[model samples]
Target: MENEVLQDVMLTATILIPILAALVEVLKKAVKLPKNLLPLISVVLGLILGVVSYKFTDLDLVLRLWAGAFAGLAGTGLFEALKTRIGTTK
Candidate 1:
């Protein structure tokens, strides 16, 4: 049904946003962002994504929080994984 399709889209967005954010953060090293701020940025972006997902899907608050947390963690994990793979540790 239409509702199921919308839910799928929202879920996909919820997952991809953080991954994409991580990718951008990793690749945009020339931007010179402070290292300490990256996690905070990811968390805030994840929270915003969760709010948008909730607005679109009407999902419960707990689920939204989980989505946000997962997204934040995913961003950090992805960044670390990429960094390891690229051998760019500080």
Candidate 2:
């Protein structure tokens, strides 16, 4: 049961991370906000997505929120990692 829950959250977060990253990228391009705020925005967006996705998963609000938070943070890290790898840091 524990493993199943973990798998569910991980799967959900994995799906959400890339989407959050893309959304952040779009916001970055459209807005002139500071780079530091991107992560926070991603988190907020994640939380919103998480809550909105309640119908898609059996997980409760708390678990969904956790998945969202993980997705948000991992999404930011993924973008940074790729950026560093590509030498595109500004």
lDDT of 2 by residue, 33-87 (tens): 9988888999999988888888889998988999999999999999988774465
Q: What's the distance in Å from true for residue 69, model 1?
A: 1.8
Worst lDDT 10-window in candidate 1: 81-90
Model 1 stretches astray by more than 4 angstroms: 1-14, 17-31, 55-58, 84-90
Among these predictions, the greatest lDDT belongs to 2
lDDT per model, in order? 0.65, 0.90
Per-candidate count of clashing residue pairs (backbone under 3 Å): 0, 0
TM-score of 1: 0.58
State TM-scores per candidate.
Answer: 0.58, 0.88
| Model 1: per-residue Cα lDDT over 18-53, one tens digit each | 565755476456587777777777777676666667
Extract clashing residue pairs from model 1.
none
Q: What's model 2's TM-score?
A: 0.88
